[model samples]
Target: MRRIAIIGCGGSGKTTIGRQLADQIGVPITHLDAVYYDDRWNRMDPDKFAALQEELVAADTWVIDGNYASTLPIRLKRADTVVFLDLPAMTCLWGIAQRGWKYRGGQHDSSGVYDRITWGFIKYVWGYRRDMAPRVRSLIAEYAQHADVRIVTSRRAARKMLTELKAAVH
Candidate 1:
């Protein structure tokens, strides 16, 4: 798939999958966190962020990963494929812990934003399925009905999907 949009709760492996998928498909990848936050974690202006997203999606091919629900429609409208990482909250929380240890004193590989874990962030991840999934599902249904939507519920499923995708691209 060419223009893909990967969305999920924090630590749900969106960035990892996005990177691997883009590499396998030989397309440019954009981590929305990189676009939205600077190294120091300052946020970009909302209008500018939306405009930038428009520009990124207008490209011939791209794989973007993020869950900015406010701007999700833009990417959803252009995506030919949408990968939603719906892994369990505990798994996601473990992912965050692992990621934090991996990048404890440094920035995230894809975003360049420093790794800072907070109670709020943890709560958000823990409550993501309950609080965010419904809205995300609705948006996908509304905006990406024509897209190839894949919901990955477990890490094993994610690995299988990536392996199959890589094999297909080869």
Candidate 2:
């Protein structure tokens, strides 16, 4: 795929999966979080965020990781494929629990965001997802009409998403 974007809630493994897929395809990749999050977990200015994303997505072949849809729509529009990790809240919680501890233990994500999935942090993102998810899903649903949007909602179905990526775009 020339341009792929991974969208999902926290702990949904979008970054992890996106990196694997990007590496398999041998293309450049960017984690929007790294570009957006400053040292204290504060966000960069919207204009700056948008500018960086716009510049990055101009590349020929790249996999972008993150669901910051506000700054992400342009890339979404340019994307040839969109991968949505649609696991439910509990599933996301479980994934966060599993990954967060690893992150606390010094694991770094491909998206370059430090893994700091504390219980408090996980709880916060979980709550935040309630507000954020509908928009993301709607975005996925909206984009699916114009482009390829494949969603993986279950653990068992995860690899099917990968296989779709592995298949050459015709």
Candidate 3:
């Protein structure tokens, strides 16, 4: 596929895979988080963010990661395929905690990469899947009506995806 989008509940490894996918394809990436979050943790205005998204998603090829339903429709329309990091709730919580720990210490984010983690954010990530999962799944189903979407429902699946991608690139 020329363009791919990675999405999942918080801390599901979208950014991580997005980077690897982009590297494999030898194309640019758009990290949706960096576009959404300002340096001080402030979010960009909706209008400005939508404008930025217009530019980023308009590319000929991109590996992007994020889940903004309002913006997702636009991205999904252009994406040839989607990779969903649908790990279990427990796993998602643990991952979110780890990522928060890694980023809260003044991390960097550019090109849709979150280079930092925070303890406080970890707790939020560690929980809330009960509510988040349904919403995420709904979005997936909605988008899948027209987009090619694959859900990776376990850690094993994630590794398998990496291996498959490696083989595909070869």
Candidate 4:
């Protein structure tokens, strides 16, 4: 499938899955974190960020990863496939901690955002299922009605989906 959107909370393994899916499908990948944050985490102008996303979506095929909920419709409209990584909050929180440890030295992330785990980020992850999931699901229903939606709730399920995708591709 082409023109995919991988969305989830802050630490839901969106980037990791996006990368693998892009590699398997041989398409370009865009991390919206990279689009939203600039050097030193300076936020990009909302207008500019939307414009950039528009340009990216114009491409014939791509795998984009992020959950900028406000702008989700932009990507969802163009995506033929949408993957929601609906993992447990605890799993996501642990993922953030693990990612922070791995990228502690301020290494460049594929998202171009070398972000630290802040209390706010933690809270966001903790509240995602309760607060964000409904909104995202609503948006999916509204904007991506025609797209194939895959809700991945566990790591094992995700791995299985990826394995099946890879097998299909090969």
Candidate 5:
């Protein structure tokens, strides 16, 4: 796939998958967190963020990763493939913990300068399937119906999908 949109709850491996896909497909990767938040974690203005995303998706090829539901339509409309990492909450929670420990005193590759893990953030991750999946699914249905949509439910499934995609591209 040329233009891909990878979406999922925090710590669901979206960045990892996006990077691998982009590298395999020979395209640039955009981590939406990098665009939305500065090194100091200040947020970009909403309108400007949307406009920037519009510009990003207008590219000939890219793999964009994020779950900013508010601006999802911008990428969804342009994506040829949509990868939704629907892994279990416990798996996602463990991911967050591992990432937090790995990047405890430094910046994340995809996220902003610091990897801050708050209680609220944990709660959000724990409840993401219940709270955010429906909206993401509806948006995908509405805007990306023409796209190749893959809902990955487990880490094993994600790996298999990546392997299959790599083989397809080769």
Candidate 6:
């Protein structure tokens, strides 16, 4: 796909899938965490973050990955494809734990934000389905009516979809 938006709750593997898909399709990938947070994990100004996203979406092709709901519509409007990783809460928590351990004392490879796994983050992952899914779904329904939406609910399914996409592209 030319323009892709990979979105989901924290620890839902958005970055993993985005990286793989972008590599397979030969497109640049932008992790919104990197755009919104600095190397020191300080927040960027809201207006600046939105402006940066605007500039990124102006490009011809890209895979933008993150769950910045406020500006989701910007990417959604320009995206030809949107992949939502709707993994279960437990699985998401597990993923977050794995990532925390792997990136302890350092930043994640996918973004400039620090890889600290806090209780708040764990709770967010735990309650994502109940708290965030509905909002995200509504946004997708409203803003991505013309986009091809793929909802994947498990890691295996995500992997299979990525493999299929790679095959199709090649």
Best by lDDT: 5
Pairs clashing within candidate 3: 31-112, 100-117, 100-118, 102-117, 103-116, 103-117, 104-117, 104-118
Point out where model 5 deviates above 4 Å.
109-113
Question: Weakest 10 consecutive residues, lDDT, candidate 2?
Answer: 105-114
Collision count of model 3: 8
Overall lDDT per candidate, in order of appearance: 0.89, 0.76, 0.73, 0.87, 0.90, 0.86
Give the TM-score of each candidate: 0.95, 0.85, 0.81, 0.94, 0.95, 0.93
| 10 residues in a row with least lDDT, candidate 4 | 105-114
Once fitted onto the true fold, the runs of candidate 3 whose alpha carbons sit more than 4 angstroms away are: 100-104, 108-128
Model 4 misplaced stretches (Cα beyond 4 Å):
108-111
Worst 10 residues of 6 by lDDT: 109-118
By TM-score, rank the candidates, best first: 5, 1, 4, 6, 2, 3
Candidate 1: pairs in clash: none
- Expressed as tens digits, the lDDT of each residue in 1-170 for candidate 1 is 78999999988999899989998888867888877988777899999999999999999799999999999999999999899998889999898889889998478764554666789988998899999999999999999999989999999999998887777677
lDDT of 2 by residue, 1-170 (tens): 77888888877888778887788778867877777886567879999888888888888888998888786577787888888887777888888777767777343645467655567766756774577777877776665566677778877787776776677642
lDDT of 1: 0.89
* Candidate 3: tens digits of C-alpha lDDT, residues 60-157: 88888887767776677677778878777688777766766766644544553554555665555555465555676776677656666778988788
lDDT of 4 by residue, 25-118 (tens): 8986788877787667788898898888999999988999999898899999999989999999999988887887888837546557676667
Across residues 22-130, which tens digit of lDDT does each residue of candidate 6 receive?
A: 8877887888887787777788898888888999999998999999888898999999889999999988888887877888847876456566567887888888889
TM-score of 5: 0.95
Model 1 stretches astray by more than 4 angstroms:
110-113
Which ten contiguous residues of candidate 1 have the minimum total lDDT? 105-114
Cα lDDT for residue 143, model 2? 55
